[model samples]
Every structure is written in structure tokens, then in C-alpha cells.
Target: MVLEGVYKVRSIDEVVELLEKYRENAKIIAGGTDIVIALRNEKITPKVLIDISSIDELKSIKDEGEFIKIGAGVTFTKIVESSLFQKNLWGLYKACRLVGSPQIRNKGTIGGNIANGSSAADSIPPLICLGSTITLASKNGKRKVLLEEYYKDKANYGMKEDELLVSIDFKKPTENRVLSFAKLGLRKALAISRISIATFLELDKKGQVTTIRVASGSLGKYPMRELEVEEFLCGKKLNERTIDEAIKVVQQSMDERLKGRSTLPYKRVAVESMLRESIGDGIKFLDGVRA
Candidate 1:
């Protein structure tokens, strides 16, 4: 059985003070989705839970000069419903949609998702694909880290004990860019992804791939960008043959990294399928057609 701890804090300052004073014994709880599950499973037992859900400063979505800054405390549902996100960040909106049930999405925060650092986390795959970065804050100050480099270990994120994820920065996609998020789960909604893929490609006026990024989750120890595949796809035409080759390269690279894992075959197939679909959709988007 799980033992519940006394939950405290209603503001960002309160949270920072708690973390500063009890960094070793306190844990931050945003949505409580991941932590509740862990508590139920006896995976973690904290003496104090600092709830940051009511932090007003950390609950907003704003447009910066070059990027859209999404407050870490914003919910998945908020992300999906935001007009700014729908108009400017279709991939991220779609990733938020893929999270879980409506209630789960309403409760889950991007900070919690990134802080958990699970390879299967829905938004992480797409964020990595978009070259996203996360800002972490503490009583001392703050620092920014690329989402791709945030995963410090297999079981946990690289965040320091006193730091809290404050926001995510989404750089404006280049003109004629195509971005997409896809995932394979056993059941439709509320299921953990067996494999997930995110694709972002920028095409020039002549239809050549100018820039491309591909990221996959649940295919390795950490959600990662398939840079080899991206490099191969650059300057290539978005054709069946080229797409197949790119998928093959990704599969081969994943195979080398995931040698003895039991889910290799399934993940390989899913990755290929998702990549092809993403590429096709991205190409259509670049061509100014519906995908």
C-alpha cells in the first residue's frame, strides 16, 4: 500500500523555499500522475510533497521574440486548446493530445512529463524532434538545457535536487517546414506507447529537404534524435525509395543500440511505419497540401 505524505505549497516562491530547505527530503508534485502511480507501486516514498500546481507564474503560454514559451505547469489539455499552439505548433499540440485520457491530460503537466524523464513520455519525443529546450529554476537561479540532453540516467532525469522545470521553449519552425508526432500503443487512448516517432523537416523552394530531425521513443534507453537518418534524408527527395532507405538507416542504428531487447522486432516495424507516414505527411505539408 502507498503512504501519502503531507502536501504543501501553493506558490512558486513557497515551492522554491521548500526545495531549498528540504532538498534531500522533499519532492515536487505537479500533476501527481507519475508520482501517484509510483507511490501506489511503492517505487517512491517522500516525507513531504511540494505541490506547485497553484504557481501562477508557472502557468502560462507566451510568445517570445523567436520562440513560444510554454510554462511548465501548463496542462496538456491547455496546450491542445491553446490557439497559439494550434496555429504555430501543430506537432506539440498533437503530442499533447496523444498523452492519455482527458482527465489525465487535464492533470498532467509538461514539467512533470519532462521531469519524470521516461523514454515513453509522449511529449518528450516530439519536443526533441522540434529541437526544444527546457528551463529549470531554483532559489539560486536558473539554467536551460536541450531536451535531448536532459536525460541523465536510465531511471531519472538530470535535474538537480533543488531545481524545478519552469518552462519549455519552442523555436519557430522554418518556412515550408513540416512537423508531425506519431505513436504506437497497444490500445487507443490512455495506453503507454510501445513506440513513438516525431518528425520535423524543412524543405526549400525546389522541394529538397533542407533540414530534418527525427526522434524516436521506446526504441532505446532514452528518447533520442536519429541524426544519422536526418543526415541521410537531408537534400534527398521525399520519394518512396529515399524514405525506405532513411527508415532502414534508422532501423539499423536502433538495432545496433538495442541489441538484446525483446521488443526489437515490433519497435523496428513501428518505427519504419511511423517514419514513412511522417515523411509523407511532412512532404505534403511542405507542398502546401493537406496531410
Candidate 2:
């Protein structure tokens, strides 16, 4: 792959400035895990490359009262090392831990993963279950969008040409809430996910589900919230019966969405176990917390 120019930007402002100048002719590179592959395959040909890997302001993780904010430049290794995620956000931690090999985790940025917008992206399903929002910045100002709505199509995310994604924010989960993730891949290590599920569940004192959010990856054109499963789980008790019913709802939806695909039969069966395991993990996490 060849580029006319490369700019190592140190701040978000510099990145936005370069984007404004180069517009569609420019592409942003952080970890380069995805972009490098795309460049090699000639899938993308950019006249200029704006590298935001060294931007200091985009690498910090902070607690902002009601929400926890993660800078876009923070790497998967950074996330796996954070006590905050290990202690509270285990779903996200687990996802990051399984992103790729150690070398890939060290180089891949969360921002890059989200920006790449692959259906198999590891971080997105969990982020969506957590009700995450992302901030897009440009010379004009910054705008926030729900992560679940960011993808307008399978191939295109809603980011503007002049906007750089700066940070992702999600409301801090309370003691009553639990989040969990499960994935099916071809192999145990460094395997691309074939299917995955993330579940966010809130339980009441009597052990009934008060609220529930279910999101999945590699199950559709893009990572998406499983609204039917969520609706069925809400206000219900997390028992074997409820879990079985939820699995059927998910299978029905998947069948309708991926009816003619070659992977449909396998995915339809695999997703049930993934969803079951994710929901079970969420319940177990909450149980351990209460204990």
C-alpha cells in the first residue's frame, strides 16, 4: 500500500484539522490492525494518512460521575489492565482479553475496532448492551450518538468525513446490575468470532429480572441489540424455563434474518448456547457480588 502523505498527529484537534483539509482523501490510522490489511488488499486508497496513535488526550479512562468515559485511543491491553473493568465491567474485560493474540491486543485500539465496524467486532456487542454512546468531533463541534445506531449500513458507519471519534461513554452499572459475554470461534486462541452474545441484566431483590439488554455480533449485517430477547426477559425470573424461551426467540429471529446464508444452520444452533451461557454468566456474576 502507498500513501501520498502520513501525519503523526499528537492531539484530537490536529486530527480534525487534517480531516477537514483532506476530507474523503484522508484516512485515520490508530493501531493499523484493520487499516493495514485494507490497504494491502487495495480495499482503501487514501492520499493522506492521519495517525492518531500518539494523541495523549484520547488515551485516558476516567469516571465522570454517572458515566465512565474511555478515550478512543485506549488499547485493548490498557483496558484489560484496568482494575475498573476487571472489577466491574467483566464482560468488556473478557471481550478485550479475547480480541486477538497478546501482540494484537497491545496494538489494537478500541476506537479502531469500533471504527472498523466489522460485524465480528469484539467490543461493540458488550458496549451496546451497556447502552454506550460515542462522541464524534469536528471543527464545528462534537456530537454524540448511541453506538447501536452508529452503523447506518453494513459497510458504512455514520461518522462524518471531518469527524474523529474521541471517546465512548456508558452509564456505570450499579450493584444490582451484571454484564456478561460469550463467543463461539473456530479455535480457542486468536480466532475470529463466529458468533457472540453480550447480556446486561438488572435483578430485583426477589431475583426477578428488572431490566435486560441483549446484543449480538456476527449474527447479522452488523452487531445489533436482540430486542425481542430483551423484551421477553424483562420482568421475568432467570430460570431454566425463561432461558430456554429466550433462546427460542433468538433462534427464530436469527432464522428470519439469515435464512438463505450458508452459515445459517450452524449459527442458528450455535447462538443458543452463546446466549444461554452469557445469561448464565450474568446471573452468576450477580450471585457472586451478593455473596
Candidate 3:
């Protein structure tokens, strides 16, 4: 792998100091799930490895006032076992639970998932639905990048070479807001997501959509907000008629985005079940709570 030194950092300041010294020559390693693969494959050759697993601050999940702050070094297995991810944030829990297999989940960090920049990253779709932001730190200071925008031009807009992604945070969905996720994989075990959908929704007392976010994975170059479908569903009551209409809008968006790709027809058809599962389950959960 052509690595010279592996500095096990105890704090963010130490990590930043190392990054400042090594700059682009250094690569941060946590969980080591994705980076190790890259190192072995010779896809990335870094002279220095800054390991952040020893930093306790980067492994905690904090409930800060109205937001949930998850440390970058936190593993997917940790999220699956956390009580904070229940109820309104269950979609995130589901996403983490379905990541790779139990062994991968134990070693895979959400930060690594985002840093990996895979188009089919499962955790990203639900994070996008939650409108999350990632914190990147350097010697100078910290910068916050919206999760949705980071994926847009990952080569350039993603974490800079001199920065370390520290944590991801988003507003805590209220009791009235429900988040749900549905994924289609080739098989039940060790299946990579072929198509996945996440929906975060809140309906008013009148049973009309007030806030809704839809996001998809493997449906585009990166997991992203389904803005057209969200726009179509806003203010509309959740029912068969509106859902059917929304599915049509999703298909049209895919048609425009894919532009005759061979996967277009398959994706168009597959997306419907994903939408129904996430959106319909979210509504039913809220409905059951009321009942």
C-alpha cells in the first residue's frame, strides 16, 4: 500500500495537525472498511495514515438540543444498536441495519460510507432525506458541507485533502414527522442495494402533507433528494390517487435523468414499490400512533 506511518490520533487537534503537516499526502482512516479495500486494490496510495479510531470524541452519538450529532468514526452497528434512532428516525436505523452484512456493519462507519463516494451507499439516501450536514476539520478551522451537495461533485466538492470529516448532524424529526426506508437488493443476505428509497414526512392535522423529503440510492450518480416527487406530494393528502400521481412524476424524472439508459425501464418500474413502501409505511406509522 506504500504507507510510511500510521499515526493513531487521540484528538481532533492532533489529527488536524497531522493533516496540516502531511496535507494531500495523508489519508484519514477510521473503521478501515472502505479505505483498506482501496489500499489493497492500489486505488489510493497515501504516504501517511492518520487513524482516528482512538479519538473518543469521534465515536459518540450526541443528542444536542434539537439536533442529532453522530461522530464520523461511529460504526453502522453502533447506529443499529442505538435507542436514539427509534421512531421518527427509524429510517436511518433501517438503512444502517441493511448495510453490507453484520461483519461489515461492525466495521463500516457512516463517515467512511460518505467518503467512499459510492453511488449506491445506503446510508446516504436517508441522510439526504434528513437534510444532514457533515463537518470537516482542518488546522485552520471547520467547514460544514450539506450532505446533498457533497455528492454533486464529489471529486472536488467533497472533503478536501487537508480536512478530516468529524461528524454529521441534522435536525431531529419531531414526533409528527416519520421517516421510513425501503430497499431492493439482489438477495436478503450480503446484498448490495440495487434501488433504495427514503421518505421523511410530516402531515398536518388535516391529513395533508406539510413537509416531505424523498431520496433515492443507485437511482442516480449519487444518493440525492427526489425534489420533483417531494414537490408533487407537498400539500397533497396521502392516498392512493396522490401516490399514483407521485410515482408517475418519479418515473418522468428518471426518464429525464437517465435519458435512454438500458437501466431506465427497470429503474422506472422498480422505483414504484420503493416509493410505496417508504411513503406508505411512514403514513401508516403516523396513523397507528393516532389510533
Give the best candidate by lDDT: 3
**What is the lDDT for 109 in model 2?**
95
lDDT by residue for model 2 over 178-246, one digit each (tens)? 778999988988887889999998888778899899999999998999999988888999899989999
Model 3 over residues 1-291: C-alpha lDDT tens digits? 468989988999999999999987899998898888889999889999999988999899999989999999999999999999988899999999998899999988998888887878889999999999999998889989899999886776687878889999999988999989999988999888999999999998888999999999988888889999999999999999999999999999888888968998989999999999999889988887666
lDDT of each: 0.81, 0.90, 0.91
lDDT of residue 71 for candidate 1: 89
Model 1: clashing residue pairs?
Answer: none
State the RMSD for candidate 3. Answer: 1.5
Q: Output the TM-score of candidate 3.
A: 0.95
In candidate 2, which residue pairs clash? Answer: none
State the displacement of the C-alpha of residue 79, model 1, in Å, after optimal TM-score superposition.
0.6
TM-score of each: 0.93, 0.96, 0.95
Model 2 deviation from native, Cα RMSD in Å: 1.6
Off by over 4 Å in 1: 1-7, 152-157, 289-291
What lDDT does model 1 reach?
A: 0.81
Candidate 2 lDDT (Cα, whole model)? 0.90
Instruction: Please give the ranking of all candidate structures by lDDT, highest first, separated by commas.
Output: 3, 2, 1
Tens digits of lDDT, candidate 1, 72-187: 99999998988865632576788888888999999999989888878888888878887888888889887888888887452354788888889999787755666787778888
Kindly give the stretch of ten consecutive residues in candidate 1 with the minimal lDDT sum: 1-10
Clashes of each: 0, 0, 0
